[model samples]
Target chain A: MNWLKYIGIFVMLLFLQVFLLDNLHWLGLVHPFIYLWAILMLPIELPRWLQMFIGAAIGMVMDLFTHAPGIHMAGCVMAAYLRPLMVAGYVQDIDRMKGAITITAIGMGNYLRLLAVLVVVHHTIVFMLEAFTFSHFGFTLLQIILSSLFSYALILMFEYLRKNT
Target chain B: MRNLLQLILRYSNFLLLLGLEVVAFVFVLRGNKYQQVAAAGAANVVTGSIQLMSDNIASYFRLRADNAQLLEENARLNAEILELLNGQTRKRDVNDTLSTRNREPLSSQEAPYIRADLDYSFIPARVIAFSEDRHHNYITLNKGSRDGVTPDMGVIGKDGIVGVVQSVSTHFSVVAPVIHEGIFISAMIRKNDYMATLHWHAPNTRRAALEDVARHVDVQLGDTIVTSGMSAIFPADVPVGIVSDVSLGEGDSYYDIDVALATDFNSLRTVHILNYTHRAELDSIQ
Candidate 1:
């Protein structure tokens, strides 16, 4: 594994997330968080434990920036824990699942499915835990659905941009 | 022990999920603003009924003190009556003054709705539970929406103003009292009509700071503070407290005056909830 490449992506994504995207809330309801790209870009060759460890580290950094401490950590860890299961579900041949999650590495259909599931799951947990109640179920659910779709679109764009990587 | 180790080894992934979620929820409960208030409100609702039972029994033992308070208020009202009879009190209106002056003493025949022309009315309520130890203290009233008690109405006791209704259920309502750090009471000194803010910053239950009183005003000892009636919630000129101490810091623009609160929260038994009739209209104007 190239440590330098991973570190570069981590720093760039975290900087964009904390300084830029955090302040840009569309329509005052949806917030597009692109920091999960760091997790999404992880290679399938990494062990499940290490993936989660990296995910938790990313989440902790996000939590430090957000001041709401455990919210991002919970979402990030769950996403990391579910990534491998999603990958296994998509890629039937075990030999093919050992590279970076790119459009070429995983076919277009499986890659979109993986992105949709992880982004929705991560956004759902984060928003639900932030509210900690179903009292305003309508507003919270709308926030989650819109945010998931928006973040999913942005993550797909990022994946397309780094296609040859 | 070997069986336990085998079980742990088999389900380590699930244990990790549980551990991570547990840590996350701990921080959420401890630090999240919404969760903390919701938890506090739910806890108050559960304990409110139990305390109501004990408060009923405990009030019987404190009747002597309560009676003394009522007697003091009665004497003060009687003195006001004598002043009004002597034509020496401040009058809000000439018609009101003339009617009050020519008013005959109540006899066996009196109107049932004497105060029908008044813009506001009071709902009698009992203080079921109150806590002064916490920074953001809350008082629970036995009256709720069922008895026409709603959120944002002012609560007052025999001696002074108490708090505003915060949340109301069917039969119970919680009050964010004057001692709570969140509420800022608008007050004016009776002598000079100097507007200042009453804030409960100091931990002392008996004292609160009268903030923003300009240094130019002569805020003497024993000066009376009352509501300014700038807000739609509270009425004008309701008694607040007395300025117990005043000290001006050198090269300061404001005097740091401390007020000795009139209503002792400890012996508080019953309170009246003020229902301002035109609150919605006043709020809409703003």
Candidate 2:
């Protein structure tokens, strides 16, 4: 039953990422990658290997959709590896079955901080790899900042909606 | 050995992360040049089908705009046909003797006056995916190798030139649109025949620059620019754009001309791919 729920979430996130979020070219700058929600919402106590594998799989799917083969996979893998470190101090006890390591369970402030750090880290690596050089450093940095903020805001909104409902 | 094994086990997660990242980096490196082409060919097979499905749904909402553009093109073509017919009738009435003379075999000196029939055919294709947000924009079309689309074939929309086909799969082709920084077409001012090269400079979709026209040419705002047909890819006299602005750089020998492009790429849906029959012969001779 628990595995079924995670699989369902994975499929839903993949569909949303490929069909919806990837197509939204808002201002040609901020592409809200809310698909990261799947990795971010994983149970805090999940095995690191499994989490990293899931992140890489999701990233590969995104890369296939965007016609960009590997940059997203690299970024997502990095994010998955760093996930525990980001939430280590805040998440004292992780509920495995409920898997409520989300914003509602972790408090808003700490959740936002975790979201910001991970998003920035992911976007920075992704954009840098996409650019492949420091020649367009300013442009790449701007993209990373704008896209991270946009993704953070979208995740926050979803968290609020889930809490209220 | 025991200590080393324990250390490896303790940091196994980090090692796993490194291994995955290395694999991803390999994928990126493989996507650099020649390998990237192969990857894109494979990627297109999957992405093309998905784009085709999405385009089917999205095309419904764009029917009105597409219809208007087709109507406008139809009207223009009708006017051109009427003009041609009128000129033919007037020429027939003006000179029966001269018309008879025109039928006679032309001398070697008059060979240049003989016009060869256009050797081009068009294959219609619908745009399944288009992006103008990037510095290097690409357009994906529904027609591909199976439909006779090949690399370097010119694509034109209703209003003007779109781009050249860059790559092709079994059922899809990718176009390097004129908006891409790398695309440059030989163009000329319609009024004076001053030749230049058209290329995208600004990020705006509706604008591009015409370069290399001499400073002495009387270029003005609102002057029409058309393809020069120097390259056999596109036919001559296809409308490219109107000159929106022109300026001379200090101490420079050429004019910096800005053109408002004829094709509105944002609303592009359907295009015609030009197939030049004599392209191989011409290429071989060149």
Candidate 3:
């Protein structure tokens, strides 16, 4: 039952991203990577290696769809590896927590911090690597900021809905 | 071996993180090369089928526009055929003399209509995927090796040049389009034949920068740009764009030019992938 629920969410997020959210790049300026929800809501107690593996796998799927090759994969792996640190920093008593990382799993203040940092980290790596140069650093920075905000907001809304429903 | 196994077990998490990142970065750095080794791996095959399905549903919306364009082309081709038939009756002797002088006797193996008289052939392909918003934009076509779409073949839309074929899979080919910074089209001013290299500067889809034209060249607004034919990919005089803006810095050796690309990439649906027969011949000399 547990595996079925997680897999269902994973498939749904990717399906939405590739078909709908991808085609709907907000105002043609920002791309909301809603698929990151799959990685974000992974079981908090999963082994570090397994989490990174799943992250890279999702990134690989996105890279294939977007024709980005390694850009998203690199971002995903880094985000997965660093997420534990961010979660630990926010909630000191993480051992008491179980199951997925959700708003209900942690308080709102801590949840927001965890989500914000991870989303920014993932977006920054993906965009910077896609740009591959600091020559147009300002433009790239603007993309990172706009895209991160859009992705962060979308993830927050999904998390909120999950907690309520 | 026992010590090494124990050490690996002790830091497996850190080791795996390092290992995965290394693999990811390899694709990042190597993906952009001409070979596009990372472009169509097994994963792309999975996504390619999904894109094909979506494209089928999406293509229905564009069917009316596609029909109109087809009708226009059909009308033009009919006119050309009618004129050719008229010319054949009126001046058969002249046509025979001029055409036979440069040609050998018709070979038995040749199918007259399949390959055009020119050195190039074209495979009609529909765009299955296109991305212009990204820095490294790629266009995926529905044709591939099975359809004879090899790398480096030129792709052109009804309006103008699109890009070169960069990678191929069984059923899909990826194009490194003119909108990408990595692609540089050798273009020339059609009026004066002044040549320049064209590259896409980020943040805009409709415009690209034309560089290396000397300041003294008689370039102007609305001047035509076309492929230079310096390379085998695209034939000479294929319309690239019309010059939209041209400016020269004071005492600068070259003109700063902007071209409104002929093809509206946002609405690109179909492209003709040019199969240049003599590409190998040209490559051998170099």
Global CA lDDT computed for model 3:
0.81
Q: Which candidate would rank higher by TM-score, 2 or 3?
A: 3
DockQ of each: 0.12, 0.47, 0.60
Ten-residue stretch with the least lDDT total in model 2 chain A: A92-101
**How would the candidate models be sorted by DockQ, starting from the highest?**
3, 2, 1
lDDT of 3 by residue, B1-286 (tens): 9999999999888899899999999988888655374656554567778888888988898899989978876786667568756866767765656555453322211122222345777788889877776788888888888899888898888788899998788888888889987889999988878889999877688899999999779998999899998888987877888899999989999999999998888888888888888878888999
* Lowest lDDT block of 10, candidate 1 chain B: B106-115
Q: Any idea how many clashes model 3 has?
A: 0
Tens digit per residue, CA lDDT, model 1, A23-115: 454544677779998887777787777777778778866764443457888899899888877777777764457767767876899888888
Tens digits of per-residue lDDT for model 2, A62-152? 7766545688899899888887766777765543334645766677888888888888888888877766777657777777898888888
Q: List the residue pairs that clash in candidate 3.
A: none
> Relative to the unseen true structure, what is the C-alpha lDDT of residue B266 in candidate 3, on a scale of 0 to 100?
80
Model 1, position B103, has a per-residue lDDT of 33
Task: Give me the runs in candidate 3 sitting further than 4 Å from their true place.
Answer: A25-27, B1-19, B79-96, B101-117
lDDT values, one for every candidate: 0.74, 0.78, 0.81
Candidate 2 chain B weakest ten by summed lDDT: B106-115
lDDT of 1 by residue, B152-229 (tens): 889887778898887776677888788876688999998888899999852467889999998889899999998888
Candidate 1 lDDT at B75 equals 80
Candidate maximizing lDDT:
3
